[model samples]
Structure formats: structure tokens, C-alpha cells
Target: MESHDRLCRRLALLAGTAVLAVDYRLAPEHPAPAAVDDVMRALEWVASRPKELGQLLPGTGLAGDSAGGLIAYLAACGLAGTPALPDVLFLAYPNADLSLSLQSVSEKGEGWGLSVQDLAFYIAQWVPDASLLGKFSPVEVARAQPLPVRTLLATAGHDPLRDEGKLLAEELARGGTDVEYRPHPDLVHGFLTLDAVSPAARHAGDSLLAAYGSLLSHTAMLRRDRNAPPDAPNGAT
Candidate 1:
């Protein structure tokens, strides 16, 4: 919720890309089932209004960072085969594992912006039962659905959640999802929003822009082909 308004401003600057950021209820105040439920409702509401996005929707993709990334994944997964199925997913240093066992968690605790303890505290405040943890984490999805969506996964080499992001990307690919992984060797977590002091953070922002362009172009090409006249011959059949 802190960054959704910022994302909306950023999206306005982009030509063909449109982003609809959800403002889910925060933790402790509005924990677990309520939080996830709020996210689902937001997704449904946004999806119900395709015209609000102009052309950057339906086949358009999803993107998020940190906790927002977690929500984006769950939203995208929930939308699979539905009216809102995203054509691609862009994740930056996502909080894929609430378990917080990634090596970077311990190694880059102070520098990563988001620490294991912070994540634990958030979860403690939000999640109702320990058993529900597995359900909330996208890492436990085990098998990915062939939504035929491409993914852009970026992780900071020095971040505490690096391996989890990497693992998530690998699992997506293993499940037949197209994934593009970027690991910034010199950066830490929360670089996208705090790039003023981190050069790598600016680079990541640029990379995300590029990834959005790629996916948009790909979607456009597919649209063109699908809408082409029947008599207009395609080289393939």
C-alpha cells in the first residue's frame, strides 16, 4: 500500500504499460485471511474493469517487489485461466519464502533493507496459524500451471532473499514457465525504491522498464497475428 500510488505515477509515465497496484489491508491491524481476502477482492475489482486500463491489460502482465511481489504472485496464480490471467510476471527480490531460510537472510541482514526478523514479525502479526504459512507462500505451489506466461525474476546478490527468488524462478521454469532471471551482484534488497544511494537500484529500474517493453512488444505481435485477415497468408500454414 505504501508504494501503489508511486507505481501508479510511474505507470502513467510509461507509454503502453499500465499498472494497477492493490492497496491491501496491513498486518496486525488486518491479518492473514483478511489480508489475502482483501487482495483477492482487489484483483477481482480491477479485472472487472478492463477498459480502465485502455489496452494494457487482459494479456498484460503483473509486476511487484518485496511483499507486494508476494501478493502479485498469489494474484496471478489465482487468476490463472481466468479473465485476469496475466501474460507475464515481473518480480524483484520477492518475499517468496516466509520461512526465511535463504542464505542472504543471515549474511546481509542489516544491509538488505528487509531483515529476517522484520519478515518474521510481519508474519507473526498477520498469519493466523502456523499451518496456514505453507498455503500463503507461493514457494509451496509445487507445480505451476501452464498459463503460458513469461516471467522476469530479479534478485540482488547481496539481498537476504536472493536464493528464494532464484528458487522461485527455477521452479517456474521447471513448471514450463518462461522466466528471465537477473541477479545484481553489487546490490541489496529494496533497491528499486531506494535507488538514490544505490547505483545498482537505478539499473534495476531500467531493467524492469526494458522487461516491460519486451513483454508488451511480444503481446503486440501475438495480437497482430491473431487478428490478421484469414486470406492474408502466414508463412506457417
Candidate 2:
């Protein structure tokens, strides 16, 4: 929670945007839908009480790193066609695919801190029922029902989950969702949380903040243009 708060504070400052850090339930005990449910509820609350949430404008986006990223994506998927759908998604090294189909899971899984075995253990704890894996996995969700929001996906080149994030970005783009894929060539998994210790991680963090800010500003501009009277002059205030 401390690390998340620190990162959120940095993002809010860098992007000049309000950040709402959710403290969802953990896995192994809460498991599967518990965390997802909490995050979905949080999204709903953000949509319902925009004034309380710093008067968040339309096109408010969702963001997370690793497991939290998966939750954010899933929540966005579930909220599709609803008033609570997020305008954008920013994922950092997200575990989008749980099938372990990507080669990076084996090649860079070990020796980089997060091993394939560690991933398996976490998956087991989160989704003990193997059959339910596809239902909870974001990649599968994207395959079944393409994401309906713009996305900024950041993948760490040295991370075990790198390929899956890349694959998801490709799938989203192919499915017609606007996506900006950024790859950090020298970072590893969990780097977003290690910015305090690693210069490379800090640089990655800055890049993500910049992308997020730009996306928000662009989306807000589009919204304003669409809402303006059809006959209004270009660049009209």
C-alpha cells in the first residue's frame, strides 16, 4: 500500500491529475472475484460521485501495475456498455494472459526475480479452479469481448510477463481499440514499484506519467469538440 501510494502521488503530481488509489482485498484468502469485485465497485463509485472524486471529468481512465493492472482491465471489461466504463487503461507489465502461453514466461521467468513457478503459485492462489482461468484472464476477456477504451500498455523487456503484455496490446489494437504500446528495454517485472531504488524504474515511471497525461488531455479535447455545436467555428472557446 505504501509503495502504491508513493507511485500514485508521483503520478498525480507529474500528470496534474487526481489519483484514487484503491486498497482492494488480496488473494490466497480473498481470491478470484473478491479483488475484482472491489475494484469494479470502486470504479462505479468514481463514476457515480465524480464531484467527490475531485470532479473527475468524463474520459477518466484506469491504471495499475502487475496484478492490479489485471484487475483494472477486467473491471473495465465487465463495465463495457455501462456508464462506468473507463475512458482509458494504462497497464504496466500486466499479467493479462494466465495460460502461460508466451515464451517469455520460460525464457525470462527465472533469474529476473519473478519466476514461472512464482507466477503459477500466484495463479493457483487467485484462481484455484483451473477451468475458471480463462474467465478471469484479461487476455481471454479481450479475445472474447474487445476492450472498448483507449489503452496505454507498458511492458518491461526483461520481465517474464513482457510478452503477454505485448500480445494484449497487439490484440487490443487489432480489435480496433486505440492503443499506445511502450516497451522499456532495460527494466524487469515490478519495476514500477521499485522506482525509489532503480533509476531505470524511475525513468519508466516518468514515461508512463507522460503518456497518461497526454492521453487524458487528448481525450478531453475530443470530448469538448464532440460536445460543441456542430456549426461552431474551429478552435472556438
What local distance difference test score does each model get? 0.72, 0.87
TM per candidate:
0.85, 0.92
Instruction: Give per-residue CA lDDT, model 2, range 1-237, as digits (tens).
Output: 786888888889887778888899988889989998888888888878756656556568899899988999998888889888888789989998988879899889889989899899999999999999999888778877877799999999899999999988988988889999999878999887788899989988987887898888888889888887777577886
Model 1 CA deviation exceeding 4 Å by range: 1-8, 11-15, 33-35, 49-58, 142-147, 232-237
Those runs of model 2 whose alpha carbons end farther than 4 Å from true positions after fitting are 229-237
Q: Over all chains combined, what TM-score does candidate 1 have?
A: 0.85
lDDT of 1 by residue, 161-194 (tens): 8888888888888888888888887887877776
